[model samples]
Target: MPVSYIQGFDPQTLREIVDVRHCRERLDELGDQRSLPALLERVWLLKVTGDLDAALAVSEQSVRVARMGGPRKDLLRARVLHATVLQFRGAYAAAVQELTTCGEEAEGQGWAALAAFAYQHRGKVFYDAGDFVNARADFKRALFLRQEAGAPEPELQSTLAAIDAAERRRADVSVAG
Candidate 1:
């Protein structure tokens, strides 16, 4: 398959839908050190399939590639993905810091949707840290940005639902107290 045709699909989504042979074939066709999204997806595929070392290497390369300069939003996306990879490594604080910087940079760049992406991840990290309040706050910020950008909401809805559930949990705790 032509690399362009293969690139038309997200590798992560493609991996789920296709066999390992075809997926690996596509990855081989696409080659390593490709575009930001492809690198992110490759890293994600490795991460999902229990290839942490490869994922980490791809993620680090993705970060470097993003930093080397392309679109600001793409850089933000790579940074966010790198932060996510960090989370898998048990570097939660570093992940959050990277996410926070990405969010702020995206906000400054006027990339609302990218900022939302950063917020969503930051919220997940905060949740893992047992900081429900901060988690909800970050999720809300992400939700608001996604809405403002007129982005689709299937994923955002889940985040909002999570925030609502967190609020309910806090209220229940208060009542119990």
Candidate 2:
């Protein structure tokens, strides 16, 4: 996962335009490792590099690996990450549906952190779709869940930033209208 926070995402796009060089560097460092963790990282790297097709393929492989060998929680996490790739590809409806299910399952299993992740990414999808109202609501839910999970300060800060971004965009739309 990228620990470096993305600053100054364009309000219009509601997504950080990742530097392909950085993602490529990470991919190079990842090498040919086929471990589940490596596969997941590759999925993220490919997604950020704007290789949505490759990302989706690797994401499917990740989910299959997790489902076959990992725990249920790991499977859910993989599914969330897969949904994020779908979100980035502009498959908004499919991404939202998958994320909604993941969020519900995580919450039902008392996994607040996982639930937060699901909700936060779903909020990003909503933001990308220009649905600021739903984005803000999901971001707020993610913030609460992160706090409940005792997430690290950086994680909490990320959610806070998301909420602020959504609010800013919402206000912009209202003013322009």
Candidate 3:
């Protein structure tokens, strides 16, 4: 997430807002269950609604829950999502650290889909940092993984678009200078 992304997230309608109101209600109702999906959804909505700190908190809790005998993929997914929250908050170093671990773990486990997902987010973090070269490389890897897994084309298209956008931006900067 970048400054432009935050500016363009001007949600005008209730549905568009993606607030954590309903998520909170669901959490309360499922207190004992601690539904991972619901918790992750709550974190995502909170971040979308501009509550970065709160989202981070829930994300941390999600990781903790995941570490407590949760599935490896769940833990990896939670950590990846948490890194996204960090990215939104401009904590690039932390986000990179988290994403790197998640990506490595996903790859080590041979989780092509999860590895692709991790790479996509990691690429976004690199893009946000203006490290276009690394970003493009990560996106390319993500695209390859998606293709190997037979994932939808939209995701592959998104990775390619990110690479193209970064290349264009870098080129523009070079010519301007």
Candidate 4:
């Protein structure tokens, strides 16, 4: 038998989901390793599993490690992931602030993929805060950046879905008001 796995944020719930088996396998493989890559993966697994506190700690460590010696791109990516953990923890302001800087730096560096990632996550943060306008704007920007970067189909689809969701919510809120 062949097994398949899919992991990402649910469009409706805005909650991240991971293949448990895959997550377990990866975690086991990473056991006790504190390397930057290992720490980043652990942070993602922990965050997806709702272990926000543990994820936050690991993400912070990953950022520190990335800052200490990792390449510039790695440091920016680490910061973006850390900001995501913060977003999940309801630290919207902090998440948005970090993501803004990450997006700017990525764009300045001509890293379209990284800039898209930062914008997409920032959109999620805005959505969680009920700022649908900003969310949709960010999502649209992410979509454009992703396209420019030649991102894979799934990534482009994800951004499109986010944009749709934000647009729908914004329309609903306006109608209700």
Write down the lDDT of every candidate, Cα atoms only: 0.73, 0.89, 0.76, 0.88
Q: Write the per-residue lDDT of candidate 4 for residues 73-156, one digit (tens) a residue.
A: 999989999999999999999999999999999999999999999999999999999999999999999999999999989889
Better of 1 and 2 by lDDT: 2
For residue 32, model 3's alpha carbon misses the true position, in angstroms, by 9.9
TM-score of each: 0.76, 0.91, 0.81, 0.92
Clashes of 1: 0
| lDDT (Cα, 0-100) at 154 in candidate 1 | 63
Give the local distance difference test score of model 3: 0.76
Q: Report the Cα lDDT for residue 89, model 3.
A: 95
User: Whole-model lDDT, candidate 1?
Assistant: 0.73
Off by over 4 Å in 4: 1-8
Worst 10 residues of 1 by lDDT: 7-16
Give lDDT: candidate 4, residue 17: 62
Q: Which candidate has the highest TM-score of all?
A: 4
Tens digit of per-residue lDDT, candidate 3, span 27-73: 45645446787777767667776788888999999899888868999
Model 2 worst lDDT run, 10 consecutive residues: 3-12
For residues 1-177, write the lDDT of model 1, one tens digit per residue. 123323232221111233455556656765765887788878766654556788789988988888897777777787888887777677889999999999999999888988988998887777666566887799899889989888776656666775775566557557877
Which of 2 and 3 is the better model by TM-score? 2
Which run of 10 residues does model 4 get worst, by summed lDDT?
Answer: 1-10
Q: How would you encode candidate 2's per-residue C-alpha lDDT over 84-168 as one tens digit per residue?
A: 9999889999999999999999999999999999999999999999999999999999999999999999888778888888999
- Residue 1 of model 3 has an lDDT of 21
